[model samples]
Target chain A: MGAWRHFPIFMITVPLLGAVLLPFLGYVREKWVPYASLLPLGTSALLGVLLIGRIPSGGYLSYHMGGWEPPFGIEIRLDYVGLFLMLVVCGITTLALVYSRRYIEKEVSGGRRTAYYVLYLLMSGAMLGFVATGDIFNLFVFMEILALSSYALVAITGNRNAVRAAFKYILMGAPSSIMVLLAIGFLYSVTGTLNMVDLAGRIAESGFTEVLIVSYILLVVGFGVKAALFPLHMWLPDAHSIAPSPISALLSGLLVEVCAFALVRITLSVFTMRASDLVMGTADAVGVAAAAAVLYGGIMAILQKDLKMMIAYSTVSHIGYIFLGLTAFTAEGLTGAMYHMLDHGLAKACLFLCAGNFIYLKGYRRIEDLKGAWGQMPWTCFAFALASLSVIGIPPTAGFISKWYLILGNVEGGKWLYAAVLLAGSILAAVYCLRVIYYMFFQAGKEGAWEEYWHDAPPAMLLPVWVLSLATLFFGVFSFLIIPSLLKAAAYLL
Target chain B: MKKVAALLFISALAVLLLYVVASMPPMGDPDNPTATHVIPRYLERAEEETHTVNVVTGVILNYRGYDTMGEVTVIFCALAAVLAVLGRERRGVIHGFVDRSEVPASVIVKTMVRFMVPFIILFSVYTILHGETSPGGGFQGGAVIGGSMIIFTTIFGLYESSRRIPLKVRAPLEGAAVMGFFLVGSLGLVGGGNFLTYAWPRVAQGLHPSLVVWLTVLVEVGIGLGGAMVLTSILFAMIREEEEIAPAS
Candidate 1:
């Protein structure tokens, strides 16, 4: 068939092709990247919509390698789970690209602007590959690609702190990646194939022993570092706080969410159901991950001064909710975890975008320095308020709906203590969100004329903040629309 | 005492490296029982598939091209960092490190080095080109070729090296190489195969086994070019820095 007919492959290729072509665009004109990068992203976003439609009717779309059928050759499977993540990745990536036009101009010079777009596209391609790959080894390779580019992108600002932060990210990321490699080695030793579907089938036949348990644990710890789950989250605050704002938005919003999605996918589809069949009652090991992530992330986020770092720490807290919901081991828990991922992705993206615009315009990242910013940048502050409300689990925002399902799942699973932690996490969210809101609106500035203090964000940056802020409410108010599909996806896992 | 301490340290490091190598399976043992993972698969397919004999090259260029892309970028980022830090200095300061008459390269040495550059480049290309059939591929050949530039910079001045090869080109060259690596790797993701799998039937059908090997070679060339450029840039930057810290005229 024609190359155009399989939009799925093109979805991954177009951005990459755009990345390759981006450098040459500079030769033609300086402005070429802004326009050229959009077309591929726009096309990839369009393909995501198509994939979503195809998945329900098609069961699962697997593209076999060079005509090598599954169980031997690598496959790229597009079921509901993969498509949902694809939508989030593409949606947020497109917004981040639009945001970067104005945001990047201020942060990076003209000479390096082309390189920024190329890194951005490479990061996106790796994430897409991470989600779509059917082989376990391929997933590790893609994870490195994503991590390496992000390390470069995070440090692209050329500040001392940015470099330091990027170094810290690499230090943690390198170990995590190596740990993942080691785990994959162990898994491959047991099962001859690196294809995950085939491994899952083989794992089911073999039964869960101590060796399998250790591998599962390694996978959790390794992926957890990337996912920023609780204790392993030492790198997130520094990396997130130091990166340029739009990059921070993408990092907090979708990057860890992708990692979480992979963890959920592997735990359920690859490790649990089959292993549980092999060794009954041992599914609780998977549940413990959710517990640790939720508990640790919540407690640490309560203690940060810098606004960006606080939000970054909060990601560690919020990621816990996703793990907790998943640990419940019910379909409802899985669905809630999935929904929580989407909710947090939107809420966090909005918050970071809003925070970024302020830092760009005002030149201060301290939470206290943001006092009365609401008066200065009403649009940005408004976006921040909406996102904060969503994060706080306010009704009719995406966070609340996800939180509701997660709490219900906890209760359904007869884990009242976990349910209470979920409630306490919401309260902590309220505390932090209100602190930012209170400082922005209530506290006086450092004594200046309103105009002197005023700093409005540009259209390029403001648009993404508002769009994601709207999506927070959109997912919350209309949680039902996506719920059925998410439920169906979760059912496949359970 | 200092000499004794230094000797002990050298011995420890040497022993550690030796231990690691000893622990690893022997170089081309196809039937090494420990070689059950992807390495064995590459060895089995190396000559039959790509026509080369070097198993390490075979794996580096074709089987794990994507990994090499990240490795290339690591060197690239290091080069960019060193350049960003040191590239701003005057050429005079960069050139002043060497005593003018100390290491004058002989005419024969110059002629041989110049001749070696193209052959080195060609051999890198050949390694990547024949990765599927042989053992040596993009990364090994690229390192060897890139090594020549460092050799050139050492004997010649930084000015000659910079004029011969600017770090600017290295940045883009690295970016393009990485972009190409991902593009090929994504084919597996797109073609109904796993990540980096050559799964698209229509695309695979049109190609002969040799042609598939050719495509693999194209990817290796990108890796080689990128790898060579990055390593040379790092070497140049290091030399330039050492030149700066020397006594001023």
Candidate 2:
């Protein structure tokens, strides 16, 4: 029990320690750094699996820093939601690190290679810390750690477009961070504690004061930018698409989901005690915005010519579905949201990795240019096709299970409009996802192009994509294995 | 037209923020919830509990050291980001800035920088060590140390500074210093204490109060050293010219 209690802190600290050691190791043996980067993430993923087993039996575990009890010291808490998110974070990180080896060696060179791995590890550790920590201020600290690393990673390619995109990301991201900081300040002033659990009780006692409302708005806008919520999602396509493929996978897969999860954690956990009207009002607002995002993102994605850009836009649309589930404020809805976070994370990462294989092999990102990819890279295209089906909520894929739950929640909540929105979103998703599949497999190609580019990705990259795509199918078919835990987490929250 | 929309947006946001700020409890009221709820415990028990007189330091280093660790990692990340963006290989000529090697440093400025560097470093060490009892701590002390290096570079130029403490030497030092904080925190766990908890009962029984104090000092020093190196590196990366690009095809 004693040993298990420290696992949450270990999950975060180990990756961070690895990140700190990477550059030095790079200095000593540059060849070894990429492989060395795997150790911490692999360990964290192992711990995450262990934690999933334990958290169900133990309920939530909180490890206070410096042995001080909270509302005093920072706390690292692992509930089912946090642990599940940690699993996603650590799992994706391990895969991305493995996938990055060949991609980074080919795309990035010199000291930048070492910097790439360092930032990757740091970003992963920061995301893990973001989900695991219980203190609001500590969450902000971790958010900045992740945010800064992401901005740098996006720009690390150093082309003119990438640099511009990263700078724009920083410009948009900084204000959101300040807004979050200010919201934390407001919450601290009112409750006099940074602890989430303590703040929840205090906020309920204080009632829905104007100050609290302001804090709520600040948090929504701040985290909204990071989550790429509609109207604030300007930075997502450029930043996510322009980054290296492995990084794109991480950013699109884990980073935005973590932010969305943070939003869910704050609304459902910290402000649980607020007036029912305010809570419902916040939900309505989020529901409407999410509905808008579903339509907007789907339509925009259909308009994109570049493959990664379309996927990035699809991320925005998928985030809407998660929000719709979240704002439904029902157990089924929350479960659906959480499940969607996992499902979308796997599907989207697979798509990005597949797209990276295409780009690496053929040196093109345009959808039209990939007309005959299915002939050359059958395995990669097959993975992409499966992931796209999952994204579009085809039956017997993970996306279907989450969308089913989401529709059930909306129907149960008596919100027919959101249900309609979900349907529209699925239809729109089909348009973009199938469009890519069509171009990849069905479209005729220019002469000699098919044979010239006919090569499969290295095993390192192809394997992870296949694993993720298959997992989507596996979970969809056998959701009973995961749904009970998701339900348990939801029950704990509501 | 774009300017107009931007102006309207900024003004509306400012107005909304101002309204919220006005509604907040008046600045620094002692009886405010922030002061009343959890702070009293920090104020009353910090000295006896954490054994640090400066409650802020105690709070930052002991009570909330995890956040401080993340902060150090943030600084480490900033340096990494700068390097990733600017550290491309080229034909000896730096990118982003014009070469300044043609200009010579003034004799008096060089002499002054040489004299000030050692004392500045000494004072930074004092600040880091004395932080538990006084106001100055790792971040401030680190800036002072880093500032000294910047001064050295300014006087001696980037070439000399690179030669003196080349990136090869500095990068590892910074990594090690940042890792030191994580090591100390994990060591607490290894010693049957919680993460970053310096006052484990087992340790207190063995080494007593000095161990906690020493742990605090160790973290402060680590942060100080890492911060100084990171700042110096950022300065170096910024001032150096862009690496010369390959000739256009």
Candidate 3:
């Protein structure tokens, strides 16, 4: 029962243990394995709810593995920030898995279904671990865990393009990993200790200077690739387009959020505000790069043709919003960025899932082909409309609140140009989102001028999509539950 | 041939020149005084607290378990990539070139290979398990397991080996293994410890800290297994030209 007391950890564990057990279980009936795999996650999600309620605000919680102390034994650390992130990731993961049951049964072959579940569970655990881990080196380990699982999950379709995209993702991903590893090596060479709290203390003791500046750059670039910050986001669209829908939801929704969370964690925790001021003379370079990402991602997304691919490109744009808020270096900016992280996650996951639903129901990929989809799958399209509105920063949607903070942050910083760019990016987002919406409702299907491509999705699919869609509005309306938590998380970081 | 040789020669020369340039550290080192930092001091102090022969492992598994989790995800991403790409093919009955010869495994070789599997797995487990107090880690263990799988594929036909453990099973196993590693790492979180910072006495009480360390190692073993299976399955599907592609349709 004490073991169950650590259910937060078990939520991550049951699925992980189940992963190892799954291969051996294959010797039994094949059909039962994916279902068996779902049990751990279902259990993990239930545990996650309990864990979230248990975690207190602004307080640190530590769980010893085998009872080891800091700088000696292994530890699992949780804060309100960590717990909240874990809840979002685990909760979405549960729904994604539920949706995957019917989706995979229809789309993937019987033999490969087990592998899909394995990769999916691995990804879920890795994302949770990424959020929960306290140590620097442990963060790197989780990064790889999530990276490899994501790679496999993306390639699961086994299309030639999936293979090619995975290969390219690796080509880009490997260097990023090596870069981060080298940065860690440099950090070790300088600081020695890899513990974040200890490292923070040591850094404070000495003082921030130039060499630390280089380390900051290295770490930013390293995490930047994962965070999809502008130039570094070249691999994102292709990778996202090629992966399966649930995998895409995991990737666009929860996985990248963890990476962004790492960036936020490192910037605020490792450097603290004082060190950040001293180290880079200001994180101005990061700020500038983030601004570029906003403009670049928005502009590039406007140019895409494929529906999923457009959403993928749009992710590049939205990530810019995350980074832009982060770089504001103000508490409001940071809080807004973190809040946007959750908001974008819900909105994007729904959008991608809806896109996948459209593709599956109708053999179409182009933005133009979505014409008349509203009449065919009204519920799905309505969900899409809500998610799209949320993403576009429409009033009464979650995205608007986050963007409002961002624009206000820019204005407060007296960087009116950045504010202008933010507004423009929002407009661009609306443009692309409306492109699909317009075609879906107004344009006729290929059957003829009057013909409509209308077919509602299975209840399983609609349920997850609508749930996320509604949450987008719910969070927008009652931003209070999360806004304070985001503020606390920001204070912890900033 | 001249172009190739010249390109190789130039590349080697460039590598040598870069090494020369890098050996100087940075020009502003004296003004910067990089080494006289406090984090370095803690690292210096780490040797006492960790009591591990290898400081690198001590920092990795114990000090920065969080980052190590991210690093493990990188490998997980690779394995997932392979699974996503290769696992979707339709398996069909043979209709093309077939291996007519029954190339049975020799008893001695089979015995040796069989003996080798447990030890390889054991050593990989040892590496990850002892990482807090030793040199190897999750990546190292995963590589070792992957190495063992290569042996399995070489001796057994890809078909038989893959059939024994299909991608469906392999994917879930991979997922669970990674999830398990994360879960173990997160144990400190639930136990009221920081993400990977366990207070040795309270969490373990009378138990040796090594017990907790060993659990982390065990988690790595699972990662190693999944990592190995995913990698081997991918390589097998890519390289193995069976008589017929499995027909999913």
Order of models, best DockQ first: 2, 3, 1
Pairs clashing in candidate 2?
Answer: A66-B197, B94-B241, B94-B242, B95-B241, B95-B242, B95-B243, B96-B242
List runs of model 1 lying over 4 Å from the truth.
A1-5, A24-31, A109-111, A273-302, A449-455, B1-112, B166-210, B233-249
**Best-to-worst TM-score order:** 2, 1, 3
lDDT of 3 by residue, A201-240 (tens): 7678766544465566667877888888778888899998
Model 2 interface CAPRI class: medium
Give the winner by lDDT: 2
TM-scores for chain B, listed for all candidates: 0.67, 0.89, 0.66
lDDT of each: 0.72, 0.87, 0.71
Residues B1-249, candidate 2: write the lDDT tens digits.
999999999999899888888988888999899889888998999998888989999888888888888888998998888889987222243334344632477788788889989999999999989999999988999999889988887777776776676666676777655577787887787677888878766654757578888888888888888888888878877765332442323
**Every model's DockQ, to 2 decimals?**
0.18, 0.70, 0.25
Taking the tens digit of each residue's C-alpha lDDT, what string does model 1 give over B1-249?
A: 999997996697466535544543355565442355444556576555444456665445444443454455444444444443344233345444444322688989888877787787777777766655566666777788778787776666677777777644654574555655666666654555444543244465646455555556667777677777767766765665666577776
Candidate that would win on DockQ: 2
Going through the candidates in order, state the TM-score of chain A alone for each one: 0.94, 0.98, 0.94
Candidate order by decreasing lDDT: 2, 1, 3
Task: State how far residue A14 of model 1 sits from its true place (Å).
Answer: 3.2
